[model samples]
Target: MTSEPAERAGVPRRSLLLGAAAGAGAVALGAGGAIAPPAQAAAPFVKGADISWMPQMEAKGYYWNNSSGVRQDLFTILKGYGITAVSLRTWVNPSSDPGNGHCSIEETAQMAQRAKNAGMQVLIGFHFGDTWNSVGVQNPPAAWAGMSYSQMLQAMYDYVYHSCNVIKYYGVTPAWVKIGNETNSGICKPTGSISKPAQMTGLLNAAYEMSKQVFPSTPVLVHLAQPQNLAGVQNFLDAYRSNGGKWDITGLSSYAQGGNVPTVLANMQTIQSGYGKPVMQVEYGGPVGKPTQVRDSLRAFVTGVRGFGGLGTFFWEPEGYPSFNGYNSSAWDESSRRPTAAMDGFLNV
Candidate 1:
């Protein structure tokens, strides 16, 4: 569940995977001639989906209405469908509420435990903002509303360490933890803006360091918005790594409405090879306007990602939209339902 894909205009697109695979079994036999195999294929890899943005706040009216029995039943449903991971977000502080209600530390821990108990890996999203954070906007939480530059940096470090500590102590440590959500603009606000890449890198490095210190075995993920921005992606990675940050995974937030599938796949391959780390499509989904269109886009996207040698991909919120007005339609809505076409693509490949 990434903020709408309204900010991904200038990214490049290339069909590296589909095109590269076309020449796999072809051999040059004569001048301007080649022999190709009658059959060609690509090996299958892991297929995982992300389930972040499930309503955690009861006041938001999107609470997991399912009882313990129902909750377990739903997990069984997902597992049977080949879903193997669950992602949840954590808010430092929410605007409507001071404490992290649905997106609190404790709530996330419980969700992680539930997913783990059901035999699914957990991916934790740590939004270093009060609410939404994306490429165009990445604001500090209301609690840190007036802190100075230095103070904010220290707070960011402390927050990461404290959060990791809690997760570790509860024995629900995430298999992968993102330092910040869709941090294309940067995180923790007035100080960590992308305008100052070095400053942003320093802040991210601090968080990464703290995360490692608290949970040495967990992988620290560095996420960016829109998979098509080649320059932005490379710039972010170069700055982040140069500033002493250590990342085990390169995560991307992509949406079908943002651009063409070929462009997204091409950019993903570039990043994956450039960083030498497994790439994860941390967030992706098509709007519910047309079910078939959405399903087809998802299928192509998933297949393209795997073809590019991606580690795994996760769908944003296959459950339902998080209503800002406090009325969640259901634990999972029809618009976000698991389309058979999309599910087949994931399960088969």
Candidate 2:
């Protein structure tokens, strides 16, 4: 779940292959023609950050400065710090609630294009809600609230299909597509609740299948929060397996408050072994003030995960600075208007 006080806060096979390869330092053609992908992706271990707050932040006059005090794009600064990929969040029909709104399909496409322009791989997450959805809250989009289970499944398919096409239209192909965000309890709740395992898995399967249809080679991730809860994670994945749900990867959100790095790492390894799926830390963050601690912790987590062949680790909203949607755990310093040492964790990783 987000820290906000307000509420919380694609492609063909041949072309798809090139897009994925482009994410790995190869040249691939996009709307703007040939572009080199991030070299870090070539390493095959993603060092990523979720800068989904960027569009809104820029709209609010927020910008970043390089280490030498030179103004630069946030993506440029992140790449300099060794970030190879970016994760973007999407909402069905979000409102303009500042902290809680504005990550609709259109905004997601624009951000994906910006990431592609910066030579970074992209990961797109679908919340399937008009607002925030996470372990604690999984409200169905208002438009689907009154629909039957069958109707909801169709809606999920259409939404994913349309969203993928928009991203493709923007000439950006995602390296990873997340079926749901932090869906520990299940997505599109009540009917799609964990208690209703079959129904829940059915909805997730719909999103997963739609993603495959659009981006045949892209991996679809099933994200859950708090890996420290081993039993909870197992139960969630077990439900998917038992219900015949499909997923290409297992993603997780592990914050400093959620558990220690070793604990999270161990749990992830166990899950990977038990489920036979690759794992990635899809969301993570540390206290902004403790730059050294944050840096060391992030470095340890990523290194440990990589040691075990874990896909990658991503810092959640690292571009978020103090007072941006009431979030303050960003790797950036508001006063300095530059990235804090915490971001250096990705350096040389």
Candidate 3:
């Protein structure tokens, strides 16, 4: 999600909501742009963020000049904004260096340790690959690439069991574990495709079972992308369930900028009533330049989810500012190097 937007948009650094001076028509935050308390009754599920870039950015000396003119890391800044949770993405094998190193198993554990130290709940997402895994790209991990389908299932189980144990050893138990990242087309190539629901079942069940064995209380999510495509979601889930798939949460990703809200809301309703499953729009955002618009869009999303029986919402990779290297979805003001009102949207009204 981060790479796609940056490469496609070529967005420039946008101005921040001037020091304590809100962006035009932006939500009025507290003094120094601190997040005022949220309306608790309206926010039943977690209000969180996907600042997976936190470790990477902090390592790069990137800092936020908070509204009080004090320098703070993005994690501290987001916590100040009343964010209650954070989602971390981890890869099977660690990548090297600043560019791709942050999401490695070790870094993820360290990052989650810090988030737990901040008192925020955590959610872990496994890409199940050495790199990005999505609809178009679901290459198996190098070590698992040549194995038979059954062997792959065993590998996934062991991986989840070990990963969950490692994450717990860091003193943070994930409240949720998305078994696979954006598995709209399924994971691990021909074996885990929706076209082969039985295989999807094998892989998903292995991860789900191992994850449960380690963290019995945490809900497992079948995260899917393109929330507006209700048909795709329904068809895939139908196939998944028929093939013995199980999940507690319907994790969706969508953006209002694409006219997806109405469809997303309707889809949530159906998935809830029809499938008896709660949903969470796990990933969403718009261009950083449109602070007011993006904030309003996010506010609308959370509000609707509150009514829709969903868990929570997270703005993907809000930590990346000043080029994001290639991720354009950052909510930071490029010029000021601070979070914009879009980030503040997590502070529910």
Best by TM-score: 2
- Residues 147-239 of candidate 3 have per-residue lDDT tens digits of 888788768766776677677667778878898888888888877878888998778877776666667657788888776777887887888
Whichever of 1 and 3 has more TM-score, that candidate is: 3
Better of 1 and 2 by lDDT: 2
Q: Which parts of model 3 have CA positions greater than 4 angstroms off?
A: 1-43
lDDT of each: 0.62, 0.81, 0.73
For model 1, give the 10-residue run with minimal summed lDDT. 34-43
Q: How would you encode candidate 2's per-residue C-alpha lDDT over 186-271 as one tens digit per residue?
A: 98988799999999998887777667666766778999998989999888999988997777679999885424788888999999
Error of 3 at 310 (Å): 1.0
> CA lDDT of 250 in candidate 3?
81
lDDT tens digits by residue: candidate 1, 1-349: 1111211322122132322232232112211222111111122344456554443433344332222223335566666656788888887765444222346665566667778888888888888876667787787888776887766666766676666666655567677788888886677666787667777876776676666555555667889887778888787787776765556678898875434878888889999899877687887765444445555666777778777777677776555543532322222443333333334434554
Number of clashes in model 2? 0
Better of 2 and 3 by lDDT: 2
